[model samples]
Target: MTADPLRIGILNLMHDKVDTQLRFTKVLSEGPYNVDVQYFYPQTHYTSRPVPDLVQKISQPLDLKQVATMDAFIITGAPIEQLTFEEITYLDEIHQLIDVLVANNIPQLYVCWGAMAAANYLYDIPKFQLPEKIFGVFHNYLRAQDPLLKGLPDGFLAPHARYAELDIDKIMEDSRLVINAVTKNNFLFSFRAREKNQYFLFSHLEYGKDALLKEYLRERNANPGVEYIKPQNYFRDPLHMKDPEFSWETTQRVFFDNWLHSVADHIATQQFVKE
Candidate 1:
């Protein structure tokens, strides 16, 4: 008999909301299993900024009642990495949502700032500001054989664009968290809390080929006077922005496919136990 479609929810907090949804949806749809995706945003945020018409058509304000029904959830990264946790206007609402997810034992995948935020809120792993943004496609070496990274090779390339780093020492000291992957510089790539059914990815595996390029251009235009750093090791010709390689395409497909498989296994196991 065929299994039910995986009910996955995404709490998208990125500025380019539509692109974020599309990229993640593409990766999530790569596997064999059917996936039902629910997109959400912080209602408190919309109260201040005008909700984009496209966002309104595609997503809803975060609903605690509905969040519990998801088999798995993804929280996307925001551009607001410079701000303190308390400085975030909608943090309390997000905390409440996370608490509900925790209470329901929902599997979570926190990407970039979302990962940092969740790490701070749940495990007290504080985020420290970096002198400059780590903007590039870096090689990430696998450190553990976690189910989430089942078929991936020893190393893979992933995009990074952040101004903060999670306290590595604190995470290493925390017995509950398992460090899965890290860069040669020892910057974290991915980690998981087995007890909480949570995964944290500092790198952007779901980024499209032009994602970083668009970000660079957008930032450049937004602040014409300010000198912006081009995404390193990304453009074939840094001057002209020539044919960029989609190096992480296969890696993302495999990673997200493994994640879905892992989630499916967890669901099956839970069902078996309940039976």
Candidate 2:
């Protein structure tokens, strides 16, 4: 018999949605599990213009009260990394999301800025601003064995576009968190909070083939005065840049498949315990 679809909640905080929906949907659908996704945007994120298509896909304003409706949830990185969490208009609402999702034992993934915010509110870990944007497709060394990194190389490449870094020392100090992945620069790339059944990933493993290149171009166009650097190891030819070489597509699919299966297992356990 076919299994019921896993219902996932997504909060697309990216201003330029582009292929966010496709990447997410495609990745999650890879494993044995099938999924149904519900998109949401915190109403307060309206300060920036929304992607027309993404805005239409959003099911409704985020509501923590309906936490029971989802088997898993995901929050993507936002462009507001330069601002403090409290300064964002949707702070309270997002906190509500973090609290309710955890309280109800929902398995979730928070990428980039969303991961940083969740780590902060949930564990008091701080985000450290970097002198320059950490924009690139970079390598990550596995710090420990994690199901999330199962099918990928022990040290793998993932895409990143951010102006800030997570407080590594503070996060390491949190006993509940297990460092899973790190970059050569020692920046924490991914970690698992075992108790919370949540994963905090600094890199955007779900990026489409040209996501980083697009981000680089957008930044350069917005501030012509600033000399934006091309993403590391991305260009087809460093001398005469062409299309970005696709790196993480297979690994990304593997990671999402693992996450989906894990969430299903966790939810099944939660339900089993209550019976």
Looking at model 2, which ten-residue stretch has the lowest summed lDDT?
50-59
Per-model tally of clashing residue pairs: 0, 0
Candidate 1, TM-score vs. the true structure?
0.96
Best by lDDT: 1
TM-score of every model versus the real structure: 0.96, 0.92
Model 1: per-residue Cα lDDT over 22-55, one tens digit each: 9888888877689989999898886767987888
lDDT of each prediction vs. the true structure?
A: 0.88, 0.82
Q: Give candidate 2 misplaced runs (Cα > 4 Å).
A: 47-59
Least accurate 10 contiguous residues by lDDT in model 1: 147-156
